[model samples]
Target: MRNAPTVRFEAITQDNWEDCVKLEVKEEQRKMVAPNWYSIIQAAYDKTYTPLSIYHEDKMVGFFMYGKDPEDGLYWIVRLMIDKRFQGRGYGEAAIRLGLELIKRQEDCSPEIVISYVPDNEAAGKLYERVGFVPTGRIVEGETEARYKVLR
Candidate 1:
């Protein structure tokens, strides 16, 4: 069996923004996360949000945007998605792990890293849980919130 490709995070730049926008989730998961374009749009106006393209070797195959919440100083992984063409290759999980590492590099970042998923996306819940995130029993805007207490 072939092994999964190494995943790396790259800043979304104008030169590659179009590539980021073109990433898409599976049809059945369309409702679970915002479209890639929307994520790019949101990152544009949100000073705290940082959008990143997930690269597997030389190809962009997924997207993730995360940052600190301005309201209360908490960090949040607002969006993460692997394109339909790249799903099931372990990219999403690898991206989140790298995202957490990025968060760790930020000064004054809160110990609790937050993320949310559609209630029905058990796959998302499982993936995050595997990285030490646990549900906080909180729901905002119909999505369930979970926290990863980073030990640093």
Candidate 2:
């Protein structure tokens, strides 16, 4: 039996930005999450948005962006997408756990962290719920809003 690769997060710097932008989801899941390039570009204009690359061992397998939402003054996991080739191997959940841990360490992090997804994205809903997020019954920009509170 083979061992699973170690998962970790790395800053999306100029050296690895291009590689991060090249990661993609499966065709049917395209609408469920924003593309890496768009998220990276969006992060550029927003200082609060910290984009990070998700790596399994030394291979970049996904992208993550978590930050404070200026409008609500709450922290959010704005984006998470594992490449099509890496889906279903537990990378998503592992990245999310690491992301949450990092978020809780932020100097200004709120007690609650938010995340949202298309109403029909069962995989996302399940994934988020499994990681401790509960739907808040609010829709933000058409996505179902959910939140996870940092437990002290």
Candidate 3:
């Protein structure tokens, strides 16, 4: 059996901004992600949100941002992406699980986790479902994004 990738989550910082900016998504896939990747790093560094770099065996491979939805108390996954060069290597799934684990470490945080992604991106939908995320029938910014909750 293939060994599972080792994953670690670290808060984004100035030192790591370059790594985050250097990550790329294919032209076809860019619309499905946040319009500003650099803003994600800035937000995290500015303390506006929690941005995490996903490292596999010490190499930065992916990123995720999470925070409480101001309108609701539930945890929300604001942004998630795997570097184009690192896609299809199972790093995305590992990074997601690592994010969930990190959220669980917080006190009084909701057991539920929610995420939004373009509905047309079948690959993303499959990945989310394969990892136990289900649709919540909610739409935002006129875009269809599936919401998922972690069942403990």
Candidate 1's residue-wise lDDT over 56-139, tens digit each? 999999998898988878899999999999888888888899999889888987989999999999999999998889999999
lDDT of 1: 0.89
Q: Write the per-residue lDDT of candidate 3 for residues 1-152, one digit (tens) a residue.
A: 56657778887777886887778777899888873366574574656368888888778888888887667788877778888888888888887777777777778578677877887888887888877777777777755556566556
Q: Tell me the whole-model lDDT of each prediction, alpha carbons only.
A: 0.89, 0.91, 0.77
Please give the lDDT score for candidate 3.
0.77
TM-score of every candidate: 0.94, 0.94, 0.87
Clashes of 3: 0
**How many steric overlaps are in each model, in order?**
0, 0, 0
Model 3 poorest ten-residue lDDT run? 35-44
Which structure among the candidates has the greatest lDDT? 2
> Which ranges in model 3 have alpha carbons more than 4 Å from their true place?
41-48
Candidate 3: residue 82 lDDT (0-100) = 85
What does the lDDT read for residue 82 in candidate 2? 92
Considering lDDT, where higher is better, how would the candidates rank from best to worst? 2, 1, 3
What's every prediction's RMSD, in angstroms? 1.6, 2.0, 2.2
* Comparison by lDDT, 1 against 3, better one: 1
- Cα lDDT of model 2 by residue, 59-107, tens digit: 9999999999888888999999999999988899888998999999988
